[model samples]
Target: MGSAWKQLPEELTGPARSLAEELRTLKDAAGLSLSELATRTHYSRASWERWLNGKRVITEQALDALIGAVECDGPALRALWQQAVAGPSGAEAGAQDTAAEADADADAPRVAGVQDTAEPVEVLPAGEPEPATAWWRRPAPLLACAAVVALVLVLVGLRATRHDDPSTPVADPGTSSAPVTVPAKPVSSDPTCQAMGCAHKNPKDTGCGKDARTLQSDVIGKVVIYLRYSQKCQAVWAAINEGQPQDYATITSSTGESEQALIHYGYDNYSLMLSAADPAVTFQVCGHQPEGNLCIAPMSDPAGMVASTPIPVGPASPPPGVGGTASPTADATASPSAAPTAVS
Candidate 1:
């Protein structure tokens, strides 16, 4: 068999001729018969013969496989492929000759045209192309988005203002108004009477004492008790001892009227009926005994009190005429007293 390595014709025209020559060279270098090369490359023997004989166009995949099998330099083969792709076909020899002549005589600068071979021109850099911006950095689009947000805020503000009462005027900082004067209601002596009458009053009065006075007492304190059906109420009480150290006290159902009560004895007769279903569970607050005896007062259910109603819980007014404005009197009138404690 003749060596597949044939010199490439100088007049080789298009890619078909170049590919055929390259394939022939690859087969020659592999030192394999056409059938053997075909088996290795998976191309049929007839197909390989036709491709190497310049009778048919060859695919780049086939050329690549042949190059890989032969271990040939790929860059050189690629350059040859490019040249063949740019060349005119054998049938267009006259046109190719004319193009060659024109290209050779191109001393003057030529206008841009499809076939202009101005040394394979590169795309212009568009005079330092503008840098790409982040999505948020675009001024027009960003401003539009900000305007939309501002519009939404303005609409929400307008809706809010519409719901507000228009008749209420904004208070002026410097304007002075007349002071609110809440008329003083006469303090009842009933609380004082109960404290003195209760017989279970601890001799030491530690159990039932002056701390059990009515809401009329000038004491300021809050007592919170957590109670369970079976468990004893845990009373956490705190009060200012401004006047004589007011002793702390608590009276429960367990403490009979005769027992010495700490704060107030009047609250002992009634038990707090805290309903598990009540939105706000009601607790009882009592007064100190020395000031007032067992006073049954229904306190706001602090467990879940929503602070909708204001209940005052202390002295009627500042002791007679104590100087600078007295504290507002607490509203301590609501009592759930069914069986009032009898003064002994």
Candidate 2:
């Protein structure tokens, strides 16, 4: 049988082409047929077809599902997908626009009495000077402009050849008039806090969730616990993906700092972050259920393996300067619960 895939449209360029090609490569590497992908992921075969064929922009949720199904680098893929959503680069768009205008001009209707074989003539209003007599079009001015263009081209060529000349002196960083550009370090999208300042702050609002990853995950009874850590924020938090009403998870640092998240109506909830710059300091996420308390810590494995320890049911000790108010849950609809007060 012939290949099921169609060639990406010729108009696709820049990030859009990149993302589509990367998706195709990942699909090929996974060796999963479209039918199998539909069964495994939330998106149907037709949705995958459109994304892969560059007919539609892929949603974040759809991308996440595909990444999970293929086990690819989620962060890198997400970044590429975001660039694609931002559309083509400025230069590419300009070129495309220019080509479109040229095509439109080619197809546009001509003047009523103008002959196609004749040299184009410009029409001028009565009493106006002809463009042929303009000062800028004079021989001396035209020669000057040509000379300036030639000088620019020669200078550019010399600059391009400078790298190959050993006699060329390197510019001193302190004395050079040219501006030296330093690559910018990655910053959180919209983080309100950083490092210690992030303590007791909402991970989502602080933009730490953008680069967060599950350090460890465990399933106790029906509840699934995700021990999430954000290297960018240097903070850790606990998320309860599945749980009962009144269920909660507390993220506590080895330094004795803690924050709790309560689930009131839904099965999902996430706690506020606790500053944890040092991974060796140890951060634990303990989920509280009616049955008992189950705790898990970040493992050395990058695979996010969860090793849990069941502890007796009890309230966690709160950090100093922290009040009884538990940071609000991720679900805004649910009312906040009475948090565990600090004990002296």
Candidate 3:
């Protein structure tokens, strides 16, 4: 069945309209309902509706989540989103026009007619002579004149009280006139987890994925393995792409701590994080497939969290009798049988 998408607002045009249309297309291609999309992404259903309908601007995070969910080309969608955001939004332009019209109405000169609600002025007989009034009877005019005179006298007194003569020396206060220095507030840090607290935790959930980098990456047969590290969380994890259902990857740290995860859903999956606060510590990431196993030895870099020696990229398999090795703290051992050559 075709998607039953609501009509976008008439004001939405140009890049914004293109983005909204593309998002709707992706949603339909994924065969995900609005509620299902909401469940899979971080945004609420209502928020998704607003963004998809062009009623609100889509954030970068929300766009990334949507692309990831639908498994679409991230760079293409990101470029479209950037184009839409770089210019003034359609909603904002409409709002600006409305405000300008309201301001013009407010600043407009009103004529004395039906629109005017002020009390009408009294009209005496046409040619009749006006009666002279005493100053006391015209209290409003007299009071206004008296107020203006009083203001003038106060200004004169203030001017006379000031020491205008340059020859006169004023008393100096002992206090320093230098500006007071206020210490700046420290900037708030990101990543909710750190060090041991990040151990065994999902890197994405702990906000470590924002700054994560691949220390080592290698392709074995049809599957690719990545040794991912997060400097902010001080942790490392393993990720596998183009994996099978039973495919799993294990990441072992120098301290003998290891974490492993099996692919259960899509072709892409990652293992839980393991704390690696010391840069001197080495790590070994291994990916296991039905045919054989592949491992990369990640050398540590003292200046940064990057690995000094990255595994060569390309399709390669481990030597015979070389399977997934166990960490020092674990009791598992390698398989003695020779692993078969991987099929490209």
* Better lDDT candidate (2, 3): 3
List model 2 lDDT by residue over 184-282, tens digit each: 224435667777999888765576655554455565665556566665677777766435568888777767788877765323457888776654566
Tell me the RMSD of model 1 versus the true structure: 47.6
- Residues 76-147, candidate 1: write the lDDT tens digits: 565454443333332232111233333442443211121222322111122442222111121245544554
Scored by Cα lDDT, where does model 2 land? 0.48
lDDT of 2 at 278: 55
Question: How do all the candidates rank in terms of lDDT, highest first?
Answer: 3, 2, 1
lDDT of each: 0.31, 0.48, 0.51
**What CA RMSD would you report for each candidate?**
47.6, 24.3, 30.0
Off by over 4 Å in 2: 1-190, 297-344
Q: Of models 2 and 3, which has the larger TM-score?
A: 3
Between candidates 1 and 2, which one is better according to lDDT?
2
Worst 10 residues of 2 by lDDT: 335-344
Query: Across residues 59-166, which tens digit of lDDT does each residue of candidate 3 receive?
Result: 555676565565455666766666555445532421222333334434532221221233211111234322321111212455436544543454344334333634
Instruction: Candidate 1: count the clashes.
Output: 36
Model 2 vs truth, CA RMSD: 24.3
